[model samples]
Target: MRRAISVGRDQLMSVGVCFGKFTKSGKFKLHITALDYLAQYAKFKLWIKPNGEMQFLYGNHIAKAHVGRISEDVPEHQGIVIFSMADVPLGFGVTARSTVDIRKLQPTDIVVFHQADVGEYLREQDTLF
Candidate 1:
């Protein structure tokens, strides 16, 4: 059995939702992210049918992505890409395409996404230089 990891509220910053087909299965599905208040922490949840297609309840809202990362240096070109687990782009769903640096994130924000089991892989302090 795999051990459950502890996640800190500091690591969760923003939320993102996406829909796409897994490369191996070629069926549609949804991906959700719960970001930490600092916008530097993230947790991901993926929901898909055995065949890879999303359940009917998802509707035409096929794909989405949200920025949970708060950085003094936001990317000049921000956008979302539909990709496989390998991080290969299947297609483009939406794009922010511009940089917007918001105020530093706080620790009480809550983001809602599809329900899926999330495993904590890394702690926020571990990523610090």
Candidate 2:
């Protein structure tokens, strides 16, 4: 039996539980507790369209065309946060391309913070208990 750790809305993007953490790399995945804490704050994030969002939630690799927007500071290797078009934190990803290169990126190019990969490990954990 594991308790769901609760964090404030202000802390959602910046907070992590025992399950994950955000270091020099971008943010890790949000626990079920904070995934809903969308709105207000926005930084180090990338917004993907519904198609991308579904694959992201389904745990598929992200592509450039799938990304609609991104934070200004997202650099190569930086752990950028993943978000749904609705502003929910979908997961984590590492930038394969820098902000400058993103403008000319191809649809098949990858993006950052792919932890837990869609909703596998996280989803699996919930169903087990």
Candidate 3:
């Protein structure tokens, strides 16, 4: 995928598999495949407990208590890829609080705000190409 993307970057311009697109403000809103790809390379990630995996797939935000591990130095409002403890890419979201700030948060406090998830494929199958 990397080779394909890099090779066609200049010539293709608007064709090929899209990972995601940069917003006007320069934030890269990740697509599911992009999230999965970045999960192995980027530090902005969260591995949730099993109990929360289903909820997250259903488009619910993650709570502090449900988080099993968080990558270091994640800032608040940063886009992050969500994963199950077994390392499956489930979705993506924005952090509600920084890694440091989470220390003072309650168990029920919102951690990651859901943006997209695998369940959306099932829920929106009719609209999906």
Candidate with the greatest TM-score versus the true structure:
3
Which regions of candidate 1 fall more than 4 Å away from where they truly are? 2-21, 25-30, 33-70, 77-95, 100-129
Mind giving the per-residue lDDT tens digits that candidate 3 earns over 19-82? 7668899997655546656667766989999999998998899999999999999999998888
Estimate, for each residue in 24-123, the C-alpha lDDT of model 2 and write its tens digit.
Answer: 7786544434333422343578888888777777767788888888888567886566778887666665688888888887778776546544476566
Which candidate would rank higher by lDDT, 2 or 3?
3
Comparing 1 and 2 by lDDT, which wins? 2
- lDDT of model 1 at residue 54? 29
The TM-score of predicted model 3 comes to: 0.75
Question: What ranking of all candidate models by lDDT puts the best one first?
Answer: 3, 2, 1
Between candidates 2 and 3, the TM-score winner = 3
Candidate 2, residue 87: how far the Cα is off, in Å: 1.0
TM-score of each: 0.19, 0.62, 0.75
